[model samples]
Target chain A: MSKLLTDLIEALRCLPGVGGKSAQRMAFHLLERERERGLRLASALEQAMQRIGNCTRCRNFSEEPVCSICASSSRDRHVLCVVESPTELAAIEQATGYRGQYFVLLGRLSPLDGLGPEELGLGLLTERLAEGEIEEMIIATNPTVEGEATAHYLAQLARAAGVKPTRLAHGVPLGGELEYVDRGTLAHAFGSRQSL
Target chain B: MSKLLTDLIEALRCLPGVGGKSAQRMAFHLLERERERGLRLASALEQAMQRIGNCTRCRNFSEEPVCSICASSSRDRHVLCVVESPTELAAIEQATGYRGQYFVLLGRLSPLDGLGPEELGLGLLTERLAEGEIEEMIIATNPTVEGEATAHYLAQLARAAGVKPTRLAHGVPLGGELEYVDRGTLAHAFGSRQSL
Candidate 1:
């Protein structure tokens, strides 16, 4: 294979779930079938990187200092949803039609990996909590250890600032089989069962 | 979402098997974490697209008029492999360790899709066979209807030019279960059983 082609394939492996074979397939697909779109993707990536930055207010992606969601007056300023990444923020927005602003941590607290609260923009989160505009902070982080720890840390900060903090409900997912559900999730679901 | 961010996400959807969610994830991954590598990928895509063109000799991708495989003196010029795409050519080269030169059709004979002999580089294939340099032509097109038709068409061309043409042997794959094997493969395996 050509060096340039190989380099492009290798670079595509940096994507979230792309492996060597997938990266190669993506590369060849670009070259053989969608060269024009591939070039457009290149331009889009370049321009997005050159212009888009973390929103100064919410830390989500934005072209300006504040993201559109953060800048919008129609959104609920009193209800803030905290997420570990922009993907999670988007998921919440899409799935639940969440009309509140978001605070993107960009990552969770991983002490072993040297990721601290400072690294996850917890200082900015504290500043937002202290602003007194937010009535509730919903923690929408994943169920992973780091995510849970980060959520706990953020909840303490919110509590200190006299803002109510809430974690997303834990339960067996809709349409999930009991046999296929993991032990931890099943236990959490059992413990959190609702009374009708 | 920012228009730039959304455009990048939309552009990433051009990749094979990438859906909207995956495209968004890829876009976010590029923007949030791998910006440097993302820029490198953009540069690689642009450079590869600007420089890489079809190899005049075999029609595989090349920065020059002829691809490295066709230009190489180390590969066998007498044995040529006909493939439907460059990815298949690469697969054959990797799996079979074949040292023969290749003729990449870039597509198969899909008459229903308006693809014909000219579209498959069969004219170039015939011209190459008529040169008397090729002693054998291996038909390595996929086992689909279009691939079979392409192989049959190329075989007639090679035979007319007095070049021997052979199809890949069909058999039950290595480590495959006989009970799980498809009927067509089982029949082919039985028909082409080898003498130990």
Candidate 2:
């Protein structure tokens, strides 16, 4: 193989599911008709890294210190939606009717993986809640074991801080991700939910 | 989403097996830890498109007019191996025991796909065989229906040119790709004989 082809294949293999043969196929496809697309991907990576920042209060991806939702004057300041990742934040945003501010933990409390409250910036969340403006905290962590543990821990933390903490409901598959679940199902899950 | 993030997700979605979720994950990974890798992929795509040319003799990917095997002094001048694409040519080369030169068809004869003998440059292959240096043409096209059709057509072309033509041994798994099969299996497949 030419050095150029070798390098392209190597780089393509860095993708999550692409193996050697698939990477080679992708490299050849890019070499054939998508060189411009490859450049665009590179440019996008650079631009996102340089331009996108974390929301000041929520720790979610944002172009400004306060994300659009957080800056929106109409959103409910009393109801805070908490999530584990920015993708989940995007999903919740896509639901299109939740006019509430958000706080992204960025990760869950996985003790075996050495992730603790500090690692998830729970201190910052506690500080934000201590201001006493927030009336409710909705935990939207995943339904996995880590998610449950994180939600339980955060509930205790919220109680200590004198804030009522609740969790998003979980019953339907929601098409595999809480983010991708249909709006109606999510609305139902949200409406028929029990307090944590 | 920012225009840059949107464009990046769009570009990443073009890759095979990369849906929206995977594209987002890849975009985030590149943003976090693979900036250099993304640049390398872009550079490699540009370089391969600019530098890699088809070998004049076999139509395989090469930096030179003629590929290394075609230019090599020790390779058997009388034996020619035929493949469907440059990737397959690389596979045959990596098997390391094929001391013959190659002929790449670029694609197979798929009537349903409008890929005919003319489209595959079979006329050029016929002309090459008529040069009389090649005593044997090994049909190593994939074991697909289109591949079989292409091999049969090439066999007739070789006959018309008054040169002996043979095919690679079969018993390769149906619909399986040569690139993923191990070297030992490939060697066995290449060694065990049955004429098609």
The ten-residue window of minimal lDDT in model 1 chain A covers A1-10
- Per-residue lDDT for B150 in model 1? 81
List each model's interface RMSD: 1.1, 2.8
Flag regions of model 2 displaced more than 4 Å.
Answer: A32-36, A49-51, A63-66, A94-97, A109-119, A130-132, A143-149, A170-196, B29-42, B63-68, B71-74, B90-97, B108-132, B142-153, B156-162, B169-196
**Candidate 2 local lDDT, residue A113:** 81
Steric clash pairs (candidate 2) = none
Candidate 2, DockQ to 2 decimals? Answer: 0.30
Predicted candidate 2, C-alpha RMSD: 7.6
How far residue B67's Cα lies from its native spot in candidate 1, in Å, is 1.2
**After best superposition, candidate 2 residue A194: deviation in angstroms?**
8.3
> For all the predictions, what are the DockQ values?
0.71, 0.30
The residue-level lDDT of candidate 2 at A33 comes to 56
TM-score, each model?
0.89, 0.71
Q: Write the per-residue lDDT of candidate 1 for residues A72-114, one digit (tens) a residue.
A: 9899989999999888888888889788889998889998988
Fnat per model, in the order shown: 0.77, 0.40
